[model samples]
Target: MARTGSGTGSGTLLCRRNIKLDSFLKRNTERAVYERIRTYEPCVVISETINKVYMHVVLSDERVYLTEYPPRALTIAFSFRRVRDIELVNDLPDFLSGKDRELCQHIRITYLTEKPAAKGRDWLRRDKREGLPPAAPPSRRNSHSPTIIRTSEGYPAHRVQGEGGTEEVHMLPPTRSASWPNPESLGLLKVPHPPARPPSKPPSLYSLSSSPSISPSPSDQRLNIGESAQVPRRMGSVLSRLLRRDGGSSREERQAELHLYAVSRTSRLYLHLQSSWNSYIIRSTLSLDPLYRRRCSVLSDSTPDKRLPSISLERTAHLFGQLSAELLQEEISVESLYLLLQELRTAAHRNVALRRLFWRSSEVCVFLVQTLEESLHGCQSLSGGYTADQLLLSTLIVQTLAVMFRETEVEAARHILLSAKKGALASRMLLALICDPELQTENQGSLADCELQALLADYLDAACSLLFEMLLLGQEASRCSPAENCVSIGWILRVIQPHPHLLDFLSYQAQHVVLVLSDLQESCLSPAQCVLLFQRCRLLLACLQYNSQLAQHLRSHFREEFRYSVKLSCAEEKLPLQYPISQPTLRLVEQILTLHRKLHTNTRALTSEKGL
Candidate 1:
């Protein structure tokens, strides 16, 4: 079959046909503009301590444009999610600026009903359908707007009779009212061009401003009497509907609720969120460590700069304490908290001003332990389905404790001793996590199951660092008074040794300790760090005591760890031995153990030997 007309022809009034489509678009755009003009939605307001969010109202799937004048060099388009509090209400002039209100007024013209081409419902039938336009004022509401006011100029004069038998007639003024469309005529069908972008403002505007006629009536629904009246082509322009509640459970409702939440930021929950975020920041960046002065406590007599980075620890603790209370009551956002913490930690590390946070990592760790334990006490879990982040936090905290002890060893040991019961908890959590690791470790198509290689590596590094910090810097002489650490180390090792092949678990430990001899060779070692390594060497030598020797290759392999431990331990050094522990080596080991024992027994008297 041959096609007739593709909306084009010589005798074709294509523009007239297209005009209806444009008219529909033009009407809807006006309603949208009128809606905007009448309502207001405030974006930023003080909620919690301080929070700001924006609000937006979507009208019939229209394309919006926003251009940045400064052409911000960085950001592309901003993304807005359905935030959790904000709103847009229909009180147009109430929320917008004077200029915006003026712009919105232009909408009333195009929004109302259009004039009928022919009378009767049959006008919408068949061949006329192709040339047919939007149905005329079949709906009563369309008769009230500006178009009716314009066509009224050609109508019969209003008939009136005076009390004294005198007759009078009058012509009405043009109305400036929002083009009200018949509620019934809306029919739920969407048009292409929205009432958001009114193109032309016809006439001097309707004079129906003060007393707007909103309700429908029987006389208003009648067919045109004689001369044709231009029907206002309205697109259901009911401004109040946009602002009023449409009952419940729609996507818009949810989005609006979220927006409102964002706007009203001062709730207790938001405060708690901010505090929680701060705590995470501390952990991610700052590697826990004793004070530099703690490092100097051996030579405490020599240096004297003790002023720390001015963070209010007491305040932070109080805040976290409150947060923990709220968080503990429910199965809270554990994973999100964990991720936020990680990011904050990273940020803190990159900025040195944040390093003092590390000095206070001990306090942060304590707060974390307290919060988690409290939360977990009565809080329920999904049978055996434990949280990956919770376990990660435990492991990370342990690693932090280990490093904090690097300078002042006794503090670490003291912490372990004090938290013995909790340390037990840590062990349990960590073992469980290892049972089913979380991080991705493979690059495969399905990507469903893989090792958490990166996380594993970090955990091990932390463990090794902690162990080293404890054995070396932590002794009878150091500030790491947590003696439980030394006792727990052997137990923890035995427990973990079973999974020794778990991503070079034992090898890192083995490699680090055996490399101690060369680390002892460092002449500029801090006596505490040096002796820490030396004593660690002795323990490592003990681990390798079965059938091993601290050879050059072994020493070179863990050069950094060995050097760190020895410098931290501040132990006396012996000449290099290109030999494994033969019988002679046994004697050497014996001598080293005696010195190590002296370290365990009388830590203070040997302070003079730290820098050597």
Candidate 2:
């Protein structure tokens, strides 16, 4: 009996050792399987903290997993459906320092790109299918229960699942669950069906459910066994609609409610190191900005400089040609053109050399002239006048050109404009735009349409400024010959005679000229400066010869300033003239005075004729 007992003990010990070996092998097998799965999955190491805690970001086909390494205690999961945008940033945060600062690049992840799915009739139906108590029949259910309406085909229209060949439909009320009430109990009558017509298409399952015309009643409709068989045919269609509505959420709403997350610098470095550790395991999901990358590379290779990097002349010409081609073909959108012009304006405003380069392109110059002419005609076109976008675009174009011309040598700039093809047509268009009576009308429209009117005013101002610059150039060109000045002066006189608005524009310009003269008189003058003043005076006198009212207005308002400037200018040059005005200037002023007297005489004669 003792030997038998010892043998039993040895057998029990061997059995226990075998069980322990099996448990050890099972654990190792599970670990090996887990490691294999992780190797195939796409992973991104976000960061390793100073505490030696590592954060691992893993991207699956439809979800993202974030987990803490070592302890593996914390985990967060996100659905890809919620991801809106992913942006890579090179800028590091200021707070990070040392190893953490050197390790990571920034990544911005945007979420909540769509609205959350609402728990509606589908959810209730799902709950009922998943072992919940069956809902009572429509006839016996409380008034608070959803109403089930029947379609013409006698199928319940609500989105309820069929059980044992029985389908039920329930209507989704407008209000929340607690406030639900029978729509028919509110005294609503059943909607009459339209006249029966030939079936043009297969009937939709949700058609009766969504129809506002249908009203539920106490009478419950049950599908016959034959009708229940047809329910399966519509199930496919119903599920497809649901899937599409859920999966393809509207991007507009997502864009309106996007959220962004920026990973720290250390996290970025960790991601970089992790990617390098296993290139195939962790690949970038977002594309890098080529322009930004190129800029960074260039900066790193070159010496640091505070000044903004200058665009090459070749690049400027290429861009100008592209813009010109787009404008000529009318292929570019107004917004796109405006944006491009804005960039050009900013560049030209900052760099004088860029403006010079722009003018040197003959194609660009011609394009500018053509664009101005088209914009002017588009604004004034009687049928289908320019849209708000086009109006704003025209204003931007004019503003950009004005910026290019501003503070530059007037003679050179004018030469560039005149030398281009259709340049003369551009000037004529500017004059016509300034004289257009419609542009001078008071703003009259709803605030929505007022933007176009405001842009119209800005366009007119820009046009006037550009035209004045051109005229100044003309004045410079005609300085050597008084006769040459008549051609331009005569053209101006003829253009203004028919348009009182043009006369007003000239008067406004005359005020600016007087102010400039006043400023020049206060400062010591160079001979060249004195010559420019003389030319300005000559141009003003020529304009005054056209309108008696304008001439009188200038004389009354600026008589002292004008006289003082003339005397100062003549004295500075010591001109061979006793009169304050030079001979050419005096001749121009005398002609203006004669025109004013004749205008007065004509007015008096008209008044006498009316009295008779």
What local lDDT does model 2 show for residue 417?
45
lDDT of 1 by residue, 1-612 (tens): 001123222111101122332233344333322221111111221111111112121111111111111110001011111111112222222223465432221111001111122233322122344331232122122221211111223432221111111111222223522232222222211233211222244311111111111111111211111112222444432212221222132331111111111121111112222222222222211212243222222211112122111123343334334433443445557665554444333323222222223333444545555644443222424543233344466455544344333212112223333335635534543332232232322343332222334444445445444454433322221211233232334444444445524234445545444444445355533323333333344445534332222322233354444434533233224322211111122343455445444433443444457745
Task: Please give, for residues 237-268, the per-residue lDDT of candidate 2 as tens digits.
Answer: 43323334444444333321111122332122
Candidate of highest TM-score: 2
Count of backbone clashes, every candidate in sequence: 80, 5
- The prediction achieving the highest lDDT against the true structure is 2
Candidate 1 differs from the real structure by a C-alpha RMSD in angstroms, to one decimal, of 33.4
True-vs-predicted CA distance for residue 290, candidate 1, Å: 20
Q: How many backbone clashes can be found in candidate 2?
A: 5
Predicted candidate 2: what Cα RMSD to the true structure? 33.9
Lowest-sum lDDT 10-residue window in model 1: 70-79
Supply the TM-score for candidate 1.
0.26
